[model samples]
Target: MDRPRCVWVRKADARVPGKLPIVYSKSYAVRFHGLERLHPFNAAKGKHIYKALCAEFSLAEGSFYEPEELTKHQLRRIHTRQYLRSLRWSLNVARIAEVSLMAFVPNNYLNHFYLRPMRFQAAGSILAGKLALDYGWAINLGGGFHHCCSNRGGGFCAYADISLLIVRLFDQEQCRVRRIMIVDLDAHQGNGHERDFSNWDTVYILDIYNALIYPRDNVAKLSIRSGAELPNHTEDATYLRQLGRCLMQSLAAFRPDVVIYNAGTDILKGDPLGNMDITAEGVIERDRLVFSTFRGLGIPVVMLLSGGYTKASARVITDSIVNLRQHGLLDLSPL
Candidate 1:
């Protein structure tokens, strides 16, 4: 297979010494005459997180790496051509975005306002994955569309970004990274990647999600190496304990070259969609635990901001990232 001309594959422009491997772009924000506001998924989630990280780190916008929009040719590496064609219809995009009103919008307008932003985020995921090999850690302020797979999309996910990232690395960096593990801490089960990687031994999935939520795909559960299904309103103590045990077990069972951390803030208390009760401190500690565990072992980690709703999600994520820096898990200084 011919490699797609992706920005991540180009090294000189990919990273700078001492700079954090944080991928983002203004194109990640979806805007369609304010119609995005009706959707529960924050249309500007990446933009908000980017601003917060800039303030917290006292960094200029140039400190971050920006990815270009993913072309259809690049998307075809994993997604089916028919599935890609379906997105050209407004009704299909409306269903994927969970915004029923978008059905009436013109497909061209939706392509510009919604799909274009998704393409940028999808490219960011691929960039962050490649950066992790160089920096030992990287974060994409956007991405983690875990509900969309190679041929299907749902739960406000229009692209299979996580799958794309995994495929890109496995294809381009096979010598360095033969095995990949997905640690999906999103409130919803990451059915997308699970379905895509099903029966593939190289990819190990460890998902912790509310069993009662949307896209309860029992079929996809077959791909998960370790999984914890939680009930509604489950608290942080229980969530974290299960997570710790699962992490240890997963590590013992299968060692991975890189870990994909889908850190979703939807588990926060009172989230309309997540339906869990994890506190802000709990979420911060959760991030610290994941980072310390992997980074301490010299394993590379690439983080993606997944399904977080509510206005406070951005603050919670920003705080969690700061806590990781304080713990020294984000240090990229040369020895």
Candidate 2:
């Protein structure tokens, strides 16, 4: 069997400085611990994890290929023009106001600056998807901003990267490929994805999440709900079993042409944001199941590291990437 080709996209600017003040009053300090206020920690931890994985796998250090800037015309394919314009203005105004009418602007002046990079990040994922069609696999180490909607942003996500990419692919007359399966294991419901792609027959989404968490409404509203919306404090074995079953069912039904995976590490035990309890080994096993399952079905996969919090959580995610590389789940052949 031939090895699959993987594209790793990481931009240094993607790591921006915190300009928003921590809102201490949003949630109860006891249960929530104001951890959500520590928004930059996850991104920092992700950088550490990526570095460790590169060293461990002896993978060549590669910079992200620059992608074309997302134009207003391109964004209009998925987002309403009015909404797009509003976001543009809100980003500029968000630096002064802690909150905006339709969206939360933690930092008024820096909103646009903080989110501006998502255009490139999203373009990278789109490129990765296209590359996967030829390479059999591609890994986008950063992306998976699944909580952002066409008109709203929340949950630390500012742009709907994969959704926009899917829309763009559909609009291109020459891109004949159809039937995309989005496998979201981010420990949170793929609200943004489900909302955008629900009516599109060619796109099928399988999202696994902790039921008792933020964005709870998303699980109930999935067009094709396949996985258990497990409760908080669920053990590792139970979660993995359910995930395996869901993957099997999705494979049998969708028989998709391509797989887009949101490999989030928040399910790890003691994750700052996640409520579930999964071990590092458990995360690796979950990755193996999803990647190997898609490969066995003869569908190419493009993986994006979605959401992971805490220091060790990133290490667990990095381990999964390394495992994929070692087992040839990710293509390493010279391009």
Candidate 3:
């Protein structure tokens, strides 16, 4: 296989004159004979967000950049061969997807119905990373599979897209992104990238997650340079306060060439899995604060929609993106 670096060596401009740097594709919606309804995660979340953004922004269908699916060779840049091989087994994919019935299905069917969408979403993340550098900011309507590391997959996260994005940028000479910060505001700790970058000083992780949630990896906590362990049912004020403190502290401790914001809406009240009580408005403000802090300082940001489990997640994310635009954080015009 050719080196992955060669794929990104062109450094072509990733922007059109008036379009937003949002990455998405129709393949991002995972559908499989109504089997997706068995899980709480909205399989069509990205499609919903895409439609809403187009309507709100008066964008045409082609306004957003649609990313192609990631090939196995591209995935090899970060994923282990064994891990990728494991994905070929329907039982293993069923475990990662948390849908027990998928274990009985054929691997080929599962690959096309489920894993293929994930690969496209992963590609969207890498594309968004490159776009962020050119446009000062970018958002992949899907991605933030933060539970999968280089060798394992779980928590409905089958791809280490966050690690892939960072690695791709570091490999490209023209990107010049030496230092990267991961602001994982998802309700669950981002153990995947944490594990991948544990010993890398150039990558700083600031994670604020519910302490009593799933995949409570104590070892991953050590990788977080600045972190907050929020209790179950934590509300807006407390969550926002801790986020502000961590953001300021992270900024003081280390400067970054780029910031990847995992803006998960699972913290919204009534979310079955997240167990947090933050409101939709709180989510909007959370995004605004993060975007303003980084964009105000002229730091490029790549936003990814992470582990939001409820049907309302898409609307909240759409509203948050609109709010960011209203706050002028998403303006792509010349500075």
Candidate 4:
């Protein structure tokens, strides 16, 4: 039986004719009473990358795709209603955010200043997934909220953007995208999506993470179709070799219609959380390998900027994106 095209996939607007398939929004910045300064993690990563891309790629403000905030209805598609409601509580949000001060902040400012940016980023992920199908590749300058699942939100992730993107694509582009693969290269384990898609054969997860880090859900490891758990301080060679092998093995095991690459720079040497020794050049090469493997096979790929804690993380990510362009893995020329 033929399937009808789903309406959830946003149609391309005429405003972005010369723009590449890069999804971003000014709202992606989490600015609230200078409280973003309190957190060690960089909250304005999307804005940093946007500025870098603007300077490097010769892009204007309106050149990128601006994603509307994801309404509760959209998030409810993957996340549980209880989980969504839990976000309204300052205590719950603070814990999920790993910011103690967030608990003191009132719900009005909490919801508006902090979670709203996340919603925009989450929606950007969904938009990127849709754009990837039309173009060969798409990049959501913000997103990769892998720490949130259907029933839970942890680590700094309040919404399961990865899960939502795949589910939306499955529900919308079902005929063309019957199967999708999540290549989570973040330094921390992607237990959220792992738990959400557990026992689901249609979604294959390839999570290469530092097994020693946070949310080391041994149970969630069961869902990974193929992946690697590196020890603390694993270097570039070992990391990339294992990644190459994993990509080859996962592709051989599952012929996916689309690939979701969680490109996280937290794996860099100085990152306090990632606990790995991968250099900036190593990070750039890592992105190239992932993009090459998927796009080379004619599979649509969506790149999400996931975990990156250090101040230099944004520069690393921006350099990697430029590397992808230079290597011909990402041709941002308007389709």
Candidate 5:
């Protein structure tokens, strides 16, 4: 078959200041302060690599699409009215507590207020879902804000964009999608997503992450094995083998109408936040296993660049997009 339609939302405004802004510090918190700055680079870098790959592979860029905007009512479908109101209110509130300023807060408070990347991030996913219905494949350059919940925001996410998009699409009866699968491969477990979708039957989440380290409570109590605590420093082969089996089993059982892939590069061994040791080549293989399997099943897949902390992590993101392009997976048109 021909290449699937790939949709990427590239908005320059979504970039945020790093978590720890101090240039130097004596504590671990200080060293990790600048983590949020990595998002823009992580998001932008992937497109750079994908474009290069498109040139090298002679892929047709016409198959790609970029969206324009996402409406607030669409966001309200997944988020509480009070939460959305609070976010807008917080944007104008003066003397807000330092602790209350989170990653999901408007960009103005963070110094790059003019960019407003969060709006684009939310809009991008909505666009990806719409395009996925039309072309059978799509991608959003910045997304995977799984930590944001229905009413509150934790982690670096401002809104639970993916969940809201899914809800809106279902409510509108857009494309007759009945069942959807979310495959989260970020280094951190999607704790917020698990909580939000726990009661929903139509959505199934398959998350893979290191057991130990950040977000200590990643795996559900029922899913944990006796010795599964602290899965840091795991061997690449072992991780891949286990992940492959899980993917196969989940796909077979759920047989979803659409699949959302959170391609996080933080699983690399040297990733500042990630404790795992997956190599560049290993990351490529992981993408292949997931994308190829879905392609074989004729299931439409939407891709998102989730998380990556290492300075050199851009290469892994680039490589994954390149592989997707070569396999006729990505639509490489200009945004």
Candidate 6:
């Protein structure tokens, strides 16, 4: 007696004959008039990355996958009813978004203007997870909302896409995926997933982050199977060494059916939020290292864009994708 497969994955919402395994959508942008400018995040981050991929890889707008908006029932798979209801209040949304003006905005328009983008990105993450199982690698231009867990949302993360992706994979049983490893190198601890999978032996969390950053969750630190606490303004050599050692050690201890790489560019130099001094080249190599490692093992990998406060994050992400292509890690040759 086998479990039912995920119907969502059976449907074709992600790829075409020519499209790569990358996932993205135009609706991923947060366009609340000029209010989005308040946050250091570039509202058009997904769009810019899409354009860059198009230029570099010669892909068209149609070549990318556009995910459907996640329904409330779908969200309930990971988020509790109480947490979901809390989002109805504009005040809570304002706090999560870090935008005070959102409190005054009409609650009716909140989902249409702001939360919709996040929901779409969440859906994209699920799609990417399924695609990774088939293609060996998949990249969602938006997602990695790691700060939000099952019962809470914070640090500009309104959804627990990471948890949902793993849960969906496990529940669906469409992809023989039981042991999942999360490699969160986002400069801040991924307390959301940590809290959700605290005692789950199947989920291995390897989180490398700054010790002095936001959401310094001591409780969540206990869940990290292997990670490092970096000092402020840690440079390339030290960061890469720590990452290399952690990856090698964790893989030797735990074997995962799938790898979720939270490729956050906030660790870049001059990032006001991440507070690390890793250069642009460091970021590129960081992505390459993660991709090459898991892909070399014949294990499927899914990469998600998490937190990057600076506008230059878009370019850095674009360049990194190109580097991945150049290194023969990303196969746009239609697998």
Of candidates 6 and 1, the better by lDDT: 6
lDDT digits (tens) for residues 262-329 of candidate 5: 77888888887777889988898888888888867788787777677676676676667678768866
Cα TM-score per model = 0.95, 0.79, 0.95, 0.95, 0.74, 0.95
lDDT scores of the candidates, listed in order = 0.90, 0.65, 0.91, 0.89, 0.61, 0.91
> 1-335 in candidate 4: lDDT tens per residue?
22355445455543356778999998888998888887767888888998999999988678888899999899889988888889889999999988898999898899999999999999999999988888888999989989889988989899999999988987767767888899999999999999998888889999999988899898989999899999999999999999999999998899989999999899999999999999998999999999888888899899998989899999999998999889998876683
**After superposing candidate 2, which stretches have Cα over 4 Å from the reference?**
1-37, 63-69, 89-112, 173-176, 218-220
Q: What is the lDDT, from 0 to 100, of the residue 8 in candidate 6?
A: 42
- The lowest-lDDT stretch of 10 consecutive residues in candidate 2 is 20-29
Ranking by lDDT: 3, 6, 1, 4, 2, 5
Candidate 6, 52-127: lDDT as tens digits? 8898877666887779999999999999999999999999999998899999999878888899999999999999
Best by lDDT: 3
* lDDT measured at residue 77 in model 4 versus the true structure, 0 to 100: 95
What does each candidate score in C-alpha RMSD? 3.5, 9.3, 3.3, 2.7, 9.9, 2.9
Q: Which pairs of residues collide in model 2?
A: 4-331, 5-331, 94-107, 94-108, 94-109, 95-107, 95-108, 95-109, 96-108
Model 1: worst 10 consecutive residues (lDDT sum): 1-10
Candidate 6 residue 122 Cα shift, in angstroms, is 0.6
Query: Positional deviation of 235 in candidate 2, in angstroms?
Result: 1.9
Q: State the displacement of the C-alpha of residue 25, model 5, in Å, after optimal TM-score superposition.
A: 34
Can you tell me which runs of candidate 4 are displaced by over 4 Å?
Answer: 1-16
lDDT of model number 3: 0.91
Worst 10 residues of 3 by lDDT: 1-10
For candidate 1, lDDT tens digit of each residue in 1-335? 23334343334444575467899899898888889889998887788888988898888658888888899899999999999999999999999998999999999999999999999999999999988888899999989999999999999889999999988987888667778999999999999999999988888999999999988999999998997999999998999999999999999999999999999989999899999999999999889999899988899999999988989999899888888988888874631
Clashes of 3: 0
